[model samples]
Structures are given as C-alpha cells and as structure tokens.
Target: MSIKKEILKTIGDLLMEKLKNLPDGLPDLMWFDKQMGQFVPPETDDTAGGTPEAGISLPLPAVLMEYEPFAWQTTGGNTQKGSGNLKFTIYCEHLADSFPGSPVRDLALQHFDFVAAVHQVLQGLQIENVMSPLTRVLDEEDLAPDGVVFSVISYNTTIFDHSTSRTRNHVMVTNPGLEVKYKEESSRPVPAVEIPAFLT
Candidate 1:
C-alpha cells in the first residue's frame, strides 16, 4: 500500500482501539469519499424501503476521516517528503430538551465530549513511519438543517516516501594484509673516497 493509505489505516486503527468503549456507545467509523458525499453509512437492506437520501439516514455518532492531498518535494534522490492534514468529522444528532438539566440536554451536547476525546487521542500522537507527530491545526463546528451537528477536527503531520529510492548495502572487510620494503643505497662515490684515503 502507498504511504498515504498506510497512514490512514494506522490512524483508523488507533482511533478504533482507543474510542471503541465510550459511555455513549461505539461510533460508526468511516472513510470520507468525495464521490459518495460527506457521509456514507453502512449498507443495510434497502429493498424493504426506498433509497435514503445521502447522509440523511446516517447512523448517529459517526466519525468520518479523510486526508488532504499534499504537495511532495524531493528530499534527495528518489525520496520525497510531504506534509499534509488529516481531518476527522464527527456527526451527531442534536437532541434538545426545554427542561433544564435534563438527560436529553446532555445527549444533545455529547458531540463536544466526543470531539474532546478524539483530540486527546490524536494530539501529539506519533505513528510508525511518519516523519512527525500529529498536531491539531483546526477545530470547527457546523450545524445542518436536519439537526445533525458536525465537528471537524484537523491534524498536521509529515510523511516520507522512499518507494523509488535505491537500496544500498555496504560490505565489511574483517582482515587486512600489509607489506614494507627498503631500497639499497645508490652507487657509492663516498665508499671509493674512503678506500683511497685509507690507502694513502
């Protein structure tokens, strides 16, 4: 798999393991696909009923994740590095109650708690093979007409791609040999002079 996909999978797995057992219940985790719209719920038997509107009948307390396209720069040789943002959109139905301190009010505002949990789990998180730890960069909320609240949280991280890099291996030499030699003295005018002086 490509680095992008691997990163997404790692994030999803981490979230799943960390957030699976919440006070409310297990949330539906999904990947955001632009072609399929912002949210796509699990497949159900639609034969009994007509096709539901896109994102209308989505399961409550859903977390949708997607990674934005990043611009890559060649670090060296065939290795490239890219810094990008990963977003998680939390969806929950707004269940308001006019009564003060009602349990329903807590349910209505549960998305905030969920958002905090997600942020706590992801902020400063470092994944294997990623160049940097995840840092939260954005947190915003949007309300839809259908009473579904959207909490979008974004994180920034850097990832490196070494798929096209060349593999290099070095061999070690355990034993080495060495040799040394001395040259004989050049022809000897000094030796002939000494012999003539001795004879004299």
Candidate 2:
C-alpha cells in the first residue's frame, strides 16, 4: 500500500484499539471525504420511514480523519521531505442536562473525555517512514445542527519520499595486485605490491 494509506490505517487502528473500551462505549471511526452524504444519519423507521433524521446517528460519538496537503522539499539525491497536518474531527451530541441530579450527568461533557483520550493515544506517536513524532498543532470546537458538537484537532509530522531513488549495483575488489617498472628496466614489469600482503 501507499505510504499515506499505511500511515492513516495505522493511526486509525491505534485509535480504535485505544478508544474501544471507554465507559460510554466505542465511537465509530471513519475517513473524511468532501462529499459527506455517507456521514448523514440514516432515516428513522417511524412515519413509514419517509421522515429524514434530524441529526447524525450515534454510537453517541464518531471520529473522522483526514490529512492536509503536504509541503515538500528536496532533501538530497532522489529523496524529498514533506511536512503535513493530520486532522481528526470528533462528533458528539451536546447534552445540556448535566444538572447535579440528572441521571445522565456523567455524559453532559463527555466529548472532552474523548478528546483527551485521543490526544493521549496520538501525541508524540512515531510511525515508520515518518520523520517526526506527531505533535498537536491546533484544536477547535464548533456547534452543528441537532445538538451535535464537533471538535477538530490537528497534528503535524514529517515524512520522506524515496520513490525517485535509483537502484545501484556496486562491486568490491579484494587483495588487488600491483605492478611497477623502473626506468632502466622498462622491458620488464615486476610485481611490486600485493594489497593485503604489502600492508602486513
């Protein structure tokens, strides 16, 4: 697989493994796309299934991952180095009823817990073919329709491209022999040096 795909899959697997056992239950993980039709919540079966859903479906929460275009520069012969940002968007339904007596009070601000857990799993993470450990570069939150709250978190890392590198074949010479001839003895070339024996 391509390096980009491998890196993304690795990240997703790590997050899935780490976040699967949270008290609130595991959240769905998906790759982000420009067309978000697939992310829309499915229609409810009520009213003969004609009514569209007001909000996205849950696992209560979900995460979408994507990466920014890489900025690249030639590092040396046939190799280029690049830096880019990887972003994760976490979506959750906002719960305003976290009053002291509410039974679901623990879930009122549960998105923060998910954010923290994501950071813990990803911060300083190192992956093969990547030059630097992942580091958080930005974090922001926004409100969506139907009480959905989403947080976008970004991390920066460096990677290298070696696709342009050429394969080279090398030959090794061992115990080479040398010949020498004196000016007066031009007719005869005598063995004057043997590499390993001469050095000894």
What shift in Å separates residue 92 of candidate 1 from its native position after superposition?
1.6
For candidate 2, what is the TM-score?
0.64
Task: Report the number of the highest-TM-score candidate.
Answer: 1
Residue-level lDDT of model 1, residues 10-87, one tens digit each, is 777777678766667535343232223434334754433222233475566666777777778877666888988877
- What digit string (tens of lDDT, one per residue) describes model 2 on residues 1-200? 56677777777778777776666653544333222333444453343212123455544466677777889897666677789988877766675666799887777667778778778888999876655799999998774444666777889999766766443223455655756655674666777985675654
Q: What is the lDDT for 163 in model 1?
A: 78
What lDDT is obtained when candidate 1 is compared to the true structure? 0.67
lDDT of 2: 0.67
Cα deviation at 125, candidate 2, in Å, is 0.9
Q: How does residue 122 of candidate 2 score in lDDT? A: 86
Ten-residue region with minimum lDDT total, candidate 1: 31-40
